[model samples]
Target: MNESAFQAGAARVDITPPLGTLINGDFITHYARFIHDPLYAKALVLQQGKTTLALVIVDICAMPKDLLDEVKIALQNETGLLPQQVLIASTHTHAAGSVASLLLGAADLPYRQKLPALLIESVKAALQHRRPAKIGFGAVDVPEHVVCRRFFMKEGYQALNPVTGGLDGVKTNPFGDEQQIDRRVAPVDPQVSFLAVKGLDDQWISVLANYSLHYVGDWENGTITADYFGVFSEEIGRLLQAGPGFVGMMSNGTSGEANIWDFLDPDRYPKAHFAKSELIGKDIAGKVANALQAIGWQEAPELSARYTEVAAGVRKPSAEELDAAKKLAAESQYETIQQVDRDALRRIYAREQVLLNDYPDTNLFPVQALQIGTGRIGALGAEFFAETGLKLKQNHQPYFTITMANGYIGYVPPAHEIERGGYETWRCRTSFLEPGAEEAIRTQLVELLKAEAERPVYSSYEIKQYER
Candidate 1:
């Protein structure tokens, strides 16, 4: 392969915060206790022809929409690339410091302050590391790691939101009574895809992977971990015996409603959180290795990026609705944390809605499409549901989405999910994007990928042979 035809570079920058930085996984505040593994902002730059594409995956909870836009604009100015050409996404690791300036946690100012500079530096480093490389794209179905957390419940036993006490659309878990769960609220995309770039020396440069399972809660509270995001890279590299300077990243997919919870078997086997994360980490790495064996590596392909912004209005509650929510919040009791935390967060956002209505508010949703030869990607600024992702893949071949991309707008569930009523669509501050946002996102993504792509042709036998 003539590596000069495909130039790829990868770099990583350490971004772990001070030990005391507040962690943002739960309702109660948590501070970084012990950093088991360092967090990083990993970058990969690909250039084919004159077009260039940049991807930065930061290990954190989320990056606010406005902040992400600001970063992209600055990066474009410095690097002389169109703002749309650079895409930054978060790993959505709950145990890491927060960049999501809303909801249950406040942005860790110290970390947030240095984030933009360090991220841009990572990209520049990658550009400096650029070398002729051979790239391959492959997907492996790892269904066992993912489970649909949201469940439609039995008629009489519908759970209630803490604030509204209104019917909870679906039970996330059946609370040990698995029989009460009627069915999964949505479908899951078990396909975990990777883009592997290797230098002319046949050494690994970078491996960019995506999966839909939410952050593994095993590393919650005291420990600051990247969850399984970094583990995927470390394990895969070790298994493949990658050379030095290798970078691996597992970005968050549309997993707002997807998790590792085995709801069907309520009484789960007892295991420590890190142990669980390790179990999942190794399993996923193995899948990546298996898929890599079958990938048809290609050289010299087209590169292009399409970015579009959609104006989605915020879903605001009426004056009367706000007043009712405040009253319920006041009367609500702090019962079990599961119930109490839900009620408290809902109530807090309910008040936010009242205060926000004093002024006009509209959210700018950014959708990005990246084309790297046979690899196609959809990057979104919101925590998208699994069904929405499945829908996108159904429409476009060889495409997957990276969530918390550029920015995060909480959870974006499907239309039916919004109607079903859950924490994700309960008219809260976190999930305030107005309805039809899903359609807008889907409509634009379809337009970008509908064009003739640089997909590699494989024989019929190769296609069927890869589907073990």
Candidate 2:
């Protein structure tokens, strides 16, 4: 590696709500009454020569596109970091305050307004605390904690989808019986990767780890929690014996189709949500702790980042699709939009966007990729299945992909899965990407990973700026 000067810093800010904050990821909303643990926004800034890059992780459901653009604009104005240079990702903790403004989740306006500033402050704080630091990278397969929630139904085992009110060929857990289940729709991503940055004194400044296990579900009844993301961070920090300035972040990987449900061993989660959360969280911490111990630290490894974007055509409703969606809405008893189930919400969102004919035959968004330390970190603004991450990791071992980064477009299932017709493919307003959209995106991302240029093609990198 080329010898050069390098500096790193990390900072955290509490974003947890005090009380009476809207909570979701469920079908309806309620006020948060208890704090399982506080939500936080953490940032890591790295500087080498004149280049600066920021990677932020927020403990929340999902950051809408507008919120991400707002934070990017604010950081650009304050820190002079280009839009591409800064990547802000959500930890995807469903129990935290809502930033996503779609069905099953709603944005807390006050929380949304304060979010950009807090995120910007984090970037600034990390910059201010920058000091000589060393970086290291390591990853291990830890598939035991996660399982694919989608299952192929055994013949004669058809089940009704709760959200869409349609019979599903494959049953998502909570709907199908184990005796009726054929096999998992797909495999889980077992790889857990960690990137450690330490100060000259040999104490950690920040440790960012990525995993494909979906959020460990448990927080409910307005108990604002950060799920396993927060738990893993705290447990790992303690195990590592991190110093004062240390900030540890555990980000959601490509877990769009994955969940903490272990089909083979259903008895493991027989308890409550928080209890089950701790069981899975500590297991992950144990695996991460062991991985951290075996890593060979690097003093000043190479660091480079690139941001590229492309517009993949949005899947518009065919006449049959439009007719089906219209039928569902017309049959619904929901007198108001608030009462519309999440499944119907998807159909309506798609219909409205198409009726106006303005969603662009294509949806354009940014994909952030950074070649740092010993591997490359790639981020997309859409929800990708574990298969997506697995494909990206091919020939790019140690490569990590963070879905729902920058902005949330919806689920981008592989073409084969799309054909399988599961809830993931149920084109809701949130997951309205066209059927072929996933292939288009994967092609673009693969090309992006191959591009060796220092400066990415910026014209295509359009940050979708708009309002609800």
Candidate 3:
């Protein structure tokens, strides 16, 4: 292994939990009884001129910052890769085993305990199989698959805010009701960006794709599947005719306010168990496979990573709100999160208020940037809006965002969206972040990316122009 030679390796380890493990990503808890498809922790490692970077993509809904921090430390001690050099992200699949408590879904203790060792194994295996390789970046617009989940309803329709008991201007997931929707609130990022890695002999080593459609959650609760994320990975590998050693990873992009549902065209989008997910995944894979033919491969491009933490205030409940929530909880007599009525939004959100009141006044959220060849991968610890991601790309081309990476700080809706007061801005445990959190995260991340790519820092005026 020559120190100057660019090399890469890829590996995956099964992370599918046993039946009866809790599956999360919903307002209520679901236990996995049947495994629709196996979940995995996939790792891709790249090295050039003594610089090494490892990216790990897991097929889970989300992992807590503390859990991933501990995993990074173990990886550091074992593989000597610093925490900054290791970029770990969740695919944001709603049907996988729960590792982080969200809404009413508590962490599956048995399944959570197995993740650390398995994640470590995936990376170590990739390290052991490094081979001389080349890399290229490719992107294709696939707009038809992603749609804005949030919408501005018709003027007469009342969009109620569950937390504040007021009318919101915007509504989320207003499924199958186009008559009430005035228009979509946002635009979907159509770009399906990917990084293709191959051995010097042109055999595929790995392909990592990023898209802004959060997840295609067509599966029923209690089914353990990776939604479309796993489908895309497998489909891409098969499309490329890659060997068994080849790996394919699809990371979640800025999709806090987007999904795969088209409400206006209701008849066109009917929910089948896994039919829609498989179709969307393979279609996106086909797009990537076709685009790969034109990529200009780079045998040795620079690899660098930058990581920082920015403090953001938690959207804690006011004293009056907390008092009201306490009264509601006492009246409901719910002993546990699961015991709370899933259909009762007021009761469910009251529990969230009580829990969020205990959160620290401020939290240090992680922001990271990784540069490989001419592509820059930005990582944030929250489910950010599509607008935030698009703003970052304005400052630099060939850039994509990885959300819920390193940790989960809940949803980082833009200040304007917060004013609209939809489900994503309803100030619950799942959406508890300050209004300005989005701007703060994006500003810091853009600076980090500029430094990593050796580009000049944007002036205040330039940033303002970009934001405009």
Give all TM-scores, in the order shown. Answer: 0.90, 0.90, 0.94
Give lDDT for model 3: 0.87
Q: Candidates sorted by lDDT, descending order?
A: 3, 1, 2
Tens-place lDDT per residue, model 2, 331-377, is 65433445544555554554443442445676777687777766778
Query: Once superposed on the true structure, which residue ranges of model 2 sit more than 4 Å away at CA?
Result: 1-4, 160-167, 174-176, 319-358, 460-468
As a whole number from 0 to 100, the lDDT of residue 399 in candidate 3 is 81
Indicate which candidate wins on TM-score: 3
Q: Each candidate: what lDDT? A: 0.77, 0.76, 0.87
In model 2, which residue pairs have backbone atoms overlapping below 3 Å?
315-434, 346-428, 346-429
- Which residue pairs in candidate 3 collide? none
Models sorted by TM-score, best on top: 3, 2, 1
Q: Point to the candidate with the largest lDDT.
A: 3
Q: Write the number of the candidate with greater TM-score, choosing between 1 and 3.
A: 3
What is residue 210's positional error in candidate 1, in angstroms?
A: 0.9
Clashes of each: 1, 3, 0
lDDT per residue (tens digit) for residues 5-87 in model 3 = 99999999999999899988887788998899999999999998767899999999999988898888888788788777788
